[model samples]
Target: MLKKAIGGSLAAMLLAGMVLGTDALSYVTTACGNVREAVKSEITPEFELDRIRNEIDKLMPEIRQHMTVVAEQSVDVKDLQREIAKKDTKLASQRDAILALRADLSSSKDSFTYRHVSYSRGEVEADLANRFESFRNGEEALARDRQILAAQKQTLRANQKKLDSMLGRKQELAVHVSQLEARLKTIQASEAVNAIEVDDTKLSRVEGMIKDLNHALDVRESILETEGNVLGRIPVEEDSVDLHADVVSEVDQHFGLTADENVAEAAQSDSL
Candidate 1:
């Protein structure tokens, strides 16, 4: 009887040990599963944040490059406008010179003609003939100068047209660039908001980049506005002055006087 009781007690102890060991193992497995799920959840967001950060990094240089292009274009337009103004001034001066020469020849021819008709056989007549020849040569030279001025005016008009066309093209490019920048800003804003919960530090960095880009764009826009105003303010045509010059030129040409001088006088008067 003592042996049997001892055997039964040993069996009971062994069974209890087995049950405890099984319960411990089950608890360890459940904890391991929960830990793995938590690690997986954390890893996904981290990976996503890293991806967004990389995308932003790649985009920054492209944005900067585009901004640089806009700045360069603005500078080019300003230079072209300055050149146009210089050409216009040169053209006006040339026109004025032609008109002045025309006037002097006309007065001299009139005086020579009066002397020739009133005293045909004297030293005064010989002097008058020489004066007439001088006046005729002067008138022919003025005609050549007037032709050169016309050619210069045509060249200036062509240059102005070319510059205006370039300006228009640049304006179109600016508008397109602005639109693209706006779209990029919207995308960055959305991405930034999404990243806020996952990584605050990275979000702050992206926000900084966005602020810098915006500041650069603002500066470029201001420059474009100022240049536009300055260039647009200059008139391409002074129609009233041009019309008066044309009328004076016609009168001189019709009266067989030197029209170059008339053209110059009219241009000078119009300048005032």
Candidate 2:
């Protein structure tokens, strides 16, 4: 809205106040007041717009960072899902293979029933070695798959946590943006220019707050390499009992073979 110019009527009204009739002076007073109102109306929107711009600028970087994570997480979740599917298929295949091997081993041990030649000891031993070796290999492979799945799940969980945290922060920042927008919509500017000066001070304070918030967000460094590792299983250490030590001690105690005693006994025998 165009602010009506308050030309010289305000000064004229004050100077002519003592001589002018009450009705004419009242008209001049009202005109000056309308012009002030119009100017105030114009300034208010600009003030609010400036404030909103400052606030939005403060929040945009963090909001954009979270948005980036949201997109990345979408891709990560899909990849994890694919990996789980592949693992499940491989696990099932290995398990089926183990079952088949077990059946073959068991059936090989059976006596002759219907045109079946029973396996001899050598054949049975060979079959056992084959079946057991396959079973061990399959079990080890399955265990590795389980470990990989566990690590993947751990990674997924970490990513999910970060996603949730970022989403929450985004929501909070969005609310702040909306509030500033609403404030702009309803603002009323003061007629005094000093009021604008005070607001400019407030703008400075708001800028400082934005700086503090930005610093806080900047300092929030994330933990690196969230994925876990599958460590190879180590054998447990224990104290080992040595039977040879006991046997050697017992033999030494029983023999009592002193060199001086043996020499004296041999001398006595030589004399005899």
Q: Pick the TM-score winner.
A: 2
Once model 2 is optimally superposed onto the true structure by TM-score, how far is the C-alpha of residue 124 displaced, in angstroms?
5.0
For each candidate in turn, the TM-score is 0.29, 0.34
Which digits, one per residue and each the tens of the lDDT, describe model 2 over residues 166-260? 66776776687678667655553334433554567888999999999988766653212122122433324446679998876676578895657
Model 2 alpha-carbon drift over 4 Å, by segment: 1-124, 189-272
How does model 1 score by TM-score? 0.29
User: Residue-pair clashes per candidate, as listed?
Assistant: 9, 0
Report the CA-based lDDT of candidate 2 relative to the real structure.
Answer: 0.65
Clashing pairs in 2: none
